[model samples]
Target: MSQQVGVVTFPGSNGDHDAWNAFANDLGVPTRMVDYRETDLDGIAVVVVPGGFSYGDYLRCGAIARFAPVMNAVREFAQRGGPVLGICNGFQVLTEAHLLPGALLRNESLRFHCDWIHVKVENRSFWTSDVEVGDILRLPIAHGDGSYFADDETIARLESNGQVIFRYCDANGAVLDNANPNGSRRAIAGIANEGRNVVGLMPHPERATDPLVGGADGRRIVTAALSALQVAV
Candidate 1:
């Protein structure tokens, strides 16, 4: 059976449609756009919190969105071992929801960055099972607040637990020192929960699924989630 992925859209979400299209057409899967107000979590194989300025970035990147009914449902869904993927602002929401650790602070440059970035696979999280450690993928990142920050102990624990899923790399997939685009600690571009069911990243993999659109490495992520569903079944 085709896996059904849910693409969540908030009041100001701009990537909902794009995510749905990429997951559905490019990946040859089925997808749904879940409203932020809904609270039901039935029959969804995977949930994607697409990138956008939810609630105008009020209070914080995802503070307001965290209180949304859909997020509450999403939280419960994640706790049940459901696969949840968050991108850009969605990453902020996951952190705020406490599904994932760390916070996404404003870029060190304090600028709205938008461009293709190189990210290294640091661990074999569920969202990156198809990705090998040290492999590099090109994906676009468009956000102003994406610097990941956690206490020293938490950082050490995350690294030790193999939860750090991605790190920023250079053109040749070489890990750079302090070359982080957003001052993210340890160059973390993405991470996963200890359960490996919830994933959050600052890059837009959905936007990178098509080489015709600039890159195809993005498809690996969506495909990974699809693989998760099969594992569950």
Candidate 2:
């Protein structure tokens, strides 16, 4: 049976349809578009918080949406080992909800950056099952408040726990200090929860799932996720 992935749609969510099509059509999986206001969490194996200006990106990208009724259910679902993926502004939401560690702030340049970026898989987290360590891929990134921040101890803790799942790199695959784009420490681009069931990243992988447009590297991620559904934890 195909894995069922739920894509949450907030008031200003812009990537819901794209995420849905990627999982359902491109990846051949069952997917549903869910409203953020809904409370039920039944039958959801995987959840995706797609990118956009949820709640108008006011008072922080995800501060407002964190109180959505569905998030409480989603939090419980995550605690039960359900897979969750957050992208772009969704990444901010995960942090705001404390699902993932660290917080996203304004870019170092204090500007919104939208373009293709190079990312390297740094750890074998749930979202990176098909991505081997050191593997690099290009994906689109569109966000303003994406500078990842955390205390010194927190950064050390994440590193020691193998939670840092992805990092930004140059075209040569070398870590570019301060090219950290979003002022993220250690050039971190993505990360997974300690249990590895939840992941959040700034880049949009769904947008790169087709060769017709640019690349199909993202299919690997969706396919890997389906495989995770079959394996009993």
Candidate 3:
């Protein structure tokens, strides 16, 4: 039997069910819904912080959600080397929690962007081992603050450590200014921690897991996590 995956639902989280469906129905793994107030992970092998306006994006995107009780458990899980994937607003939460490096700022366009964009895989992280470097996946991004920013030293460190997992790119896999939807630094769309166990991205992978909705490219991400967990076990 496939191991259980946990999908965390913050107060305003909107993609929790989408994540659960991707893991349970599409990937054939059992899934558990983890409420933001819950303090335990319940033996889940992997955890996903789905996208949405956590705490209504009040003080900041994820500033408030970072203090949720479930985040403490999520932090503990990541500290123990368990894989955690955060999408969109969830990505912001990861940064606020310091689980992942760098911060997401408002888009250079100063407007909310909601469209399909191509992202090139740059390195093999826990959630991207199934994809080859330079492989482009068309994923939908919906956020007003998707611009990734980090200081020169931190950016250099992340690059040197191979923590950059994805970069916004053209369909032909060219990393160019024209393809950068949110003006992220170095066109980065996703990144992982040094251990590669925690990944955070601005795109909504769960929304693309079903071909009926669009394409199944996002399924590879969930499967990669499952493969990683199985190897660890």
What's the TM-score of every candidate structure?
A: 0.96, 0.95, 0.96
* Range of the 10 consecutive residues with the lowest summed lDDT in candidate 2: 224-233
lDDT of 1 by residue, 100-189 (tens): 999999999999899999998888877887778888899999999999999999999999999999899898877786457899998999
Backbone clash total for model 1 is: 0
Put the candidates in lDDT order, highest first.
Answer: 3, 1, 2
By TM-score, the better pick of 1 and 2 is: 1
Error of 1 at 104 (Å): 0.5
Instruction: Give the lowest summed-lDDT range of ten residues in model 3.
Output: 224-233
Per residue, candidate 3 scores C-alpha lDDT tens digits across 125-192 of: 88897888878999999999999999999999999999999999999999999899999999999999
lDDT score at residue 64, model 2, on the 0-100 scale: 89
Candidates sorted by TM-score, descending order?
A: 3, 1, 2
Clashes of each: 0, 0, 0
Evaluate residue 133 in candidate 3 and report its C-alpha lDDT on the 0 to 100 scale.
84
- lDDT for residue 176 in candidate 1, whole number 0-100: 82
